[model samples]
Target: MLLLLLFLSLPPLSAAQLCHPNDLAALLAFKNSFSNPNSSLPSWDPQFHCCNWYGVECNDTTNRVLGLDIASVDLHGTIPPSLSKLHHLQRLRLHKLPNLVGPIPPELGQLPLLGYLVISWTNISGPIPSFLTNLRSLSYLILSFNRLSGPIPPSLPSLPYLYAIDLSRNLLTGPIPESFGHFLLSTALDLSHNMLSGDIPASLGNVNFSRIKLSRNKLSGDASVLFGKDKVADTIDISRNSFEFDFSKVGFMESLDVLDISHNKIYGSIPKQITEAVYLQFLNVSYNRMCGEIPTGWKLKYRSESWDNSSFFHNRCLCGVPLDPCK
Candidate 1:
């Protein structure tokens, strides 16, 4: 009789009690203040609970809210600080919400169980909150094409599980932090189209990468030394900057498919060694002080625009390919 009484007294699991009270309260608070221009967010009535909310998902056994996806929802307002209350949240996608503004909440870093985060193409501005470095379980973080400014925090590399990080197309200024080299496990690191200025960190050459784009910045120094022979994938774009150095000593990019180092202050001859890049498909080194016979090779013969320039007029020493032989 005692066992039966104990069993009968236990509250039954139901959708109404899907999440922790605090978690539910936090979600409701966020919904109340933010303007959802499209009315895409589902009715977050407490009686119905979060289980039926548009983008939210609950763990079947625990009934705790585990995901929040608001991608392209036209959400406007600051990221609610109360979002941290949902300790079990595993995925958060707020991509392309141009209306969203204000600093990314530091409280987001307090989520111990979070995994995926995508806020790209939003109006979110300010330094990436330092608290984010604590997300040790993060696998994918995409904040590219935002208005975020300031130095990328050095602590980012400490996250052992991070695989993809895209911070391109921001106003971020400062040297590519030396800490970037610590992300040896990263698959794609895109820091392009920023105001970052400094020598390409040589340490980056040590990390194996699949696609690395550092183009259209104020970055300088010899490109050859900055990208070591890592035999990874096939893309490296460091074009449209003030890099000035000799390209002759630079070794071949055997695995490279696209290389765009155009419109820079680079001064030197296109080294014969470059012909060894067997897999090169796209090459653009135009508008620089490159002089000498364009190495007759499979890639160069087809890419006519790869050698365009007024620099050829200044570089009286250059010859062959698009230009007539040295006079």
Candidate 2:
């Protein structure tokens, strides 16, 4: 009779407690630390429940926070540690928040159900958290336009279902990880405008991609590493780097639509392969140490500015087409 009486007295677990109650309190504590200059996040009042807060959504059935979408809110201050409390969170969007600063909390990797994470255009610095690889269910990740630095994490290739990745406009350095070849289903991979150095990873030539950008870095080596067996569409910008190679030897040059290798140290005669790229719309090999007869082609005539530089002066051995024949 005593055991039965004790069971009857215990309070049942409610759906509101799907996750720990302290999770809610933690988010509230974070709000307390920052100054909301615009009063835009007024929904973060202490008296009201978190479910009523702006940019936060809860599942109706479990009353658990499921989504946090705060794009372009001009929100300033560091990301709150309390967010890890939302164990059921599926989407976290915090784009265009220029005032957002500090490293992304590695604790965020604990969200098992997270699918979409967009934190672009912030001032967040430091290496990408390795813990983020724990989000096995994530599909879209955009960390573009930030102050993130360090080698690209090799673990990123483990994300089997990832479709798009944009890490452009940062201070990331180091060779492209060999594991990047594993992203067979990826549609876009943008690593442009970083301090990335070393030869383009040869493994990249094996993976299929819709768009690839490695422009404006200190990357070196031949251009042949990009053209895999598959036909890639969109742009290829390796421009503004120190790539040194014989353009005549490049293999499978027909797949690209836009190829820009300007401002490099490349040399040798333009190859006949240039005419084979029938779909080529934009080609800029200007300001390189290239010489010999210019390859006669459909679009080559219009790219005068790309080829009219003093570097061509050293190649006095020969020239023709748009340029005065070597005196």
Considering every candidate listed, which one attains the maximal TM-score? 1
**CA lDDT scores, all candidates in order:** 0.77, 0.75
- Model 1, stretches more than 4 Å misplaced? 1-14, 19-22, 36-40, 43-49, 58-63, 299-319, 322-327
Candidate 2 stretches greater than 4 Å from native: 1-33, 43-66, 251-255, 269-279, 292-327
What tens-digit string does per-residue lDDT give for candidate 2 at 149-176? Answer: 9999988878877877888999999988
Best by lDDT: 1
lDDT (0-100) at residue 262 of candidate 2? Answer: 73
Q: In each prediction, how many residue pairs overlap at the backbone (N, C-alpha, C within less than 3 A)?
A: 1, 1
Summarize candidate 1's per-residue lDDT along 57-91 as a digit string, tens digits. 88888778888887767577888888888889889
RMSD of each: 4.1, 6.7
List TM-score per model, in order.
0.83, 0.75
TM-score computed on alpha carbons, candidate 2: 0.75
